[model samples]
Target: MANPPLTPEDQERYQARLQALIVEHRDLDQVISHLAENPPPDQLLVPRLKKRKLQLRDQIWEVEALLMPDEPA
Candidate 1:
């Protein structure tokens, strides 16, 4: 089912949240890269970080869809 359209306040909130998620995702990418390069990275930590990054990406996509939903033809 289609979700109800967001009000102006809700849209603003979502935009803020999306921006924060994007920043966090970028930061995680940098950390993951650094960890991979620094010798003998913790096996457990890297995987966990990668997983979190994926989750963040999913969340960002969801918020974007909410903020800018597609129109029907």
Candidate 2:
């Protein structure tokens, strides 16, 4: 069955949310890099941050999927 189409407003909202998530994910990547380079990094905090980054990535992919139109087979 074909999925219901999204309203314009819904697409706009999803785009905005996706952008925010991408920014956050990028920030996390930089922070992780900095922490790894610095001595005495907080090992526990790094793992948690990495996990959150992964979650954000998943959310990003989901939002992207929603925004994109289905391809005809």
Candidate 3:
């Protein structure tokens, strides 16, 4: 569904949340990459980091959907 128009406060909060999400997404991605690069790494860390990354990805998608819900079908 289309996101309702953002008030000034809404816009500010959205921007803040988006920034935080971006940072978290990037951090999780980096962790996954590091685990991949290192051999015999923390076996559990990879899956956990990847799972966190996926969660962040979902959040990003949700925010993007809110931002431009009319982009396509």
Candidate 4:
């Protein structure tokens, strides 16, 4: 079954969430890079940060897909 279209308010909320997730993902990338450069990086923390970043990326993709679904051929 087709999903119902999002209301204007829902669209706005989704956009806001998507932006926030993108920002968080970018921030995590910076932190991860910095940590890798610094001597004796916390092996545990680095992996956790990377995992979170991947989760955020997945969320961003989901929101984007909801906002603009692919058209059928």
| Top of the candidates by lDDT | 1
Where does candidate 2 have its weakest 10-residue lDDT segment?
A: 34-43
Q: lDDT tens string, model 4, 18-66?
A: 9999999999999989888983445699889999999999999989988
Scanning candidate 3 in windows of ten residues, the lowest lDDT window is 64-73
Query: Evaluated with TM-score, which candidate comes out highest?
Result: 2
What residue pairs are clashing in model 2?
Answer: none
C-alpha root-mean-square deviation, each candidate = 2.0, 2.1, 3.2, 2.4
lDDT of 1 by residue, 14-67 (tens): 999999999999999999998888844457998899999999999999998888
Instruction: Give the distance in Å from residue 73's predicted Cα in candidate 3 to where it truly belongs.
Output: 18
lDDT of each: 0.90, 0.89, 0.77, 0.89
Candidate 2: tens digits of C-alpha lDDT, residues 22-69: 999999999889888883445698888899999999999989988887
Deviating ranges (above 4 Å) for candidate 1:
none
Candidate 3: lDDT over CA atoms?
A: 0.77
Query: Alpha-carbon error at 61 in model 2, in Å?
Result: 0.5
lDDT of 3 by residue, 4-73 (tens): 7767887778778888999999987776777688845457878877888889889988776666536454
Tell how far residue 50 is off in model 3, in angstroms. Answer: 0.4
Name the TM-score of candidate 3: 0.77
